[model samples]
Target chain A: MSHSFRVEATADRLPEANAGLDAWWSGAGLPDEARFAFELVLEEIFMNVVMHGSPPEGAPCMVDVILDRQGDGVVMEIADDGLPFDPLAMESPDTAAPMEDRRVGGLGVYLVREMMDTVHYRHSEGRNRLSVFKSIGST
Target chain B: MNVNIESTEGGVSVARAHGRLDFGASAEFQKALEGAVGAKPKALVIECSELEYVSSAGLRAFLVAARAAKAGGVGFAACALQPAVKEVFEVSGFSKIIDVQADLATALAALA
Candidate 1:
């Protein structure tokens, strides 16, 4: 089974992205933990596109999210026409660093990588595409 | 999202966060944190028993509040995290950097 949705790269559109996933996840019969994992990853990717990837000068911002159930796992594809930035390419912040020396932000990418089983990035035709995979019923 | 300051007793400021702390709630979360930190309480505790959901944006708010507490020489901690919220903290390694207690009493006592 598969589901897809498009979101304008606006903060307000987050609820739509979330609602769309909620409806499908309910029908997909995923556990609470698995659903939370997917929700976190989607929020991170969607917000990144809305806040950083999109141009500050008001360029058109759009993101396409596709979900597919494969065997015992689910795969999510996020594609955006914003900047050509690969979230995976960013350096991981030292999570163990003390509060005084810690840097804000960048935790989103780290969480996405940790929650998903496999994450791949591609930049094609002026678009950034990210594929995230996770096994169903697994935390 | 609704963040109500539950109490400020014995130099400990306790804030009860309710509802989803996702992207839409960041501003409200930050405002509440600011109010808590502004009091310069010796310690700050965010009770999350009523919090239903948390996303990266919510985590970011927590991080920012933590930083503010450190800068202001105030103690900060979180307690009563729902299981799913705890998982997010663990996965992001935030559990290592911040003080997360399993319940409200322990968190308040530790702050005291």
Candidate 2:
């Protein structure tokens, strides 16, 4: 089964994205862990775009999210029509740094890469699309 | 997410976060943490006993708050996280920078 949804590219609209995912996941009947993983990944990517995507001034931006069930797991694709930024190519934050020395900027993208089983990114048609896969029913 | 800031006997600000802390709640979560840090208490404790989940945005809030606390010469710690939430902190290496304790009592003790 596959489901797709869209949200405005604004940080305030994040709840709507989460609501859409919850409505779909609840009926899809996936395990709690799988659902949690998707939720975390979705928030990270969506928030990054909303916060830093730098859409055209005064223009509206939208983020598209698609979920497909793949065997015992699920594949998620998040695409945004905003400034092109490949989160995959970003540097990983020094997680071992001291609290005073640590910076929070790149941690979200790093978390997305670590949590998802597989992740890929591409820029096409002026949209930044990120693909992530995670297995359910098994850690 | 809901955050309730409490004052411990040791003059620590314990911010108890309930429900899920994600992008949807990041703004409020960050605000609450900022409030706790602004008070300039001797220490700030994030009580996550009831928090079921946290996202990268949420983690960022904690990091920012911890930084603020350090700047103000206030201690910072988080405790009683659910297993899944703990995994998020561990994987993100937040546990390495901040004090992640086993329970609220321990967190308060550390702050004291």
Chain B structural similarity (TM-score) per candidate? 0.96, 0.97
Give DockQ: model 1: 0.78
Runs in model 1 deviating more than 4 A are none
The pairs that clash in candidate 2 are none
lDDT of 2 at A9: 82
Cα lDDT tens digits, model 1, A37-97, are 8888899999888877888787658999999887678899999999888899878878888
What residue pairs clash in candidate 1, if any at all?
none
The positional error of residue B83 in candidate 2, measured at the CA in angstroms, is: 1.7
**Candidate 1 docking classification:** medium
lDDT of 2: 0.87
Name the weakest run of 10 consecutive residues (lDDT summed) in model 1 chain A. A96-105
lDDT of 2 by residue, A16-56 (tens): 99888888888787776668778888988998888768655
Worst 10 residues of 2 chain A by lDDT: A51-60
**Candidate 2 TM-score for chain A:** 0.92
